[model samples]
Target: MDKIRRWVQEGGTLITLKNASEWAIKQGIVKEKLLIPANGGWADTTATRAASTAPASEGKKTKETASASTPGSRRTDFVNQEHEGTRAIAGSIYRTDVDLTNPIAFGLTDRRLYVFRNGTTFLRPSRNPYATVAQYTATPLVSGYVSKANLKQISNSAAIVVSKVGAGRVVLFADDPNFRHYWHGTARLFTNALLLGPLLNLPEGPATISAEEE
Candidate 1:
């Protein structure tokens, strides 16, 4: 913790696991750890794969190399980003009841995903590519090449709604059923995902879930 404290004090805001490891040396978190780049180890793999259950065009396959690296990005022990944005890292009540039924489901591998973001009040970043605030939750679904599986079914077809939200071209896939469940605490873990629907929704397919946008 001390090494981490020094890194934070030294203007190290954004970081990855490797970066954290390096910072540990200065702050004594790890006692002389070296700074090494994280290959594809931290990038979100679930976001780009077709998986066995959900397949799609929009959710195309973006191949990930175990050692490949991208620019302006870092690897965290958390979501394991491919780049700067949250492609699909998730949080939730438990591991099994994850939120994969939603497109964000892939991150948890068809499980109950959750969000570690701020909450309903704040807005998204100024130059945000997505429509939601920086606080919403998600699990990476799919990306890359010719994928047509996006037209497939989510976990619970009837219990949720996958469509665009707001006018800014954001496609938010939300659920109305969890409103009561999240509050109950004992309610299903995924119930929070449904309750969070209205708040964390993002843009769905304007372009083909298969075609790449320039």
Candidate 2:
């Protein structure tokens, strides 16, 4: 975020797309002409059944830190105090290690894939696009291409609550068949908005334009 903030302040543009539209525009990924289509509504699978589960990419476990014993009830603030000062000043502190014996996998043997988080397995058909968000929420089915866990949320073709993404702001965009176009624009807009805060110095400047094109 800090680095991204600096870039946006200096006049940087973030680009994103769905359906791999931009991916299609480039070579290698799509061997042929790839024209992204308009988005179709979510698909429904009420009668479908849940299929499988997959573990989120594991975070590596660090050596246990013995908690400090207290008089009444022992309380530890290890996770809080450990990375206090340098967390922001330093670069990203990404770690992935699951001290577990086996990582879980959740998915179905279908064309689409759904991803989820908060760590739990699903028992529904998650994919196959629907015509409306109403029909999409009628039942749970695991079916779309999910990444970063929480597969069903974004992958859901039906009624999806996108409130939790990017500071809990609900952004409504018209659908384009490729859907990727919206996400790409959304993701870029978000990155632009956030990084621009410090970069554009909105708190201290005259006026700064956000990702809003108009």
lDDT of each: 0.27, 0.24
lDDT of 1 at 210: 15
Q: After superposition, how far is residue 88 of candidate 2 from its true place, in Å?
A: 32
Task: Highest lDDT: give the candidate number.
Answer: 1
**Runs off by more than 4 Å, candidate 2:** 1-3, 16-151, 156-214
Per-residue lDDT tens digits of candidate 1, residues 1-214?
5454554344333222212222322333221112122353221122211242344533344223222445546546654545323332132221113334443332333333332211111111112223221112222223222112211111111112222313211222222213434433223323433344444445432432212111
Tens digits of per-residue lDDT, candidate 2, 45-153, equal 2211111111232211111111223222565577866644432212111111111111110111222212121212111111212111111232233433223322333
Best by TM-score: 1
RMSD of each: 20.9, 22.4
Off by over 4 Å in 1: 1-158, 167-186, 189-195, 206-214
Q: How accurate is candidate 1 locally (lDDT)?
A: 0.27
Q: Give lDDT for model 2.
A: 0.24
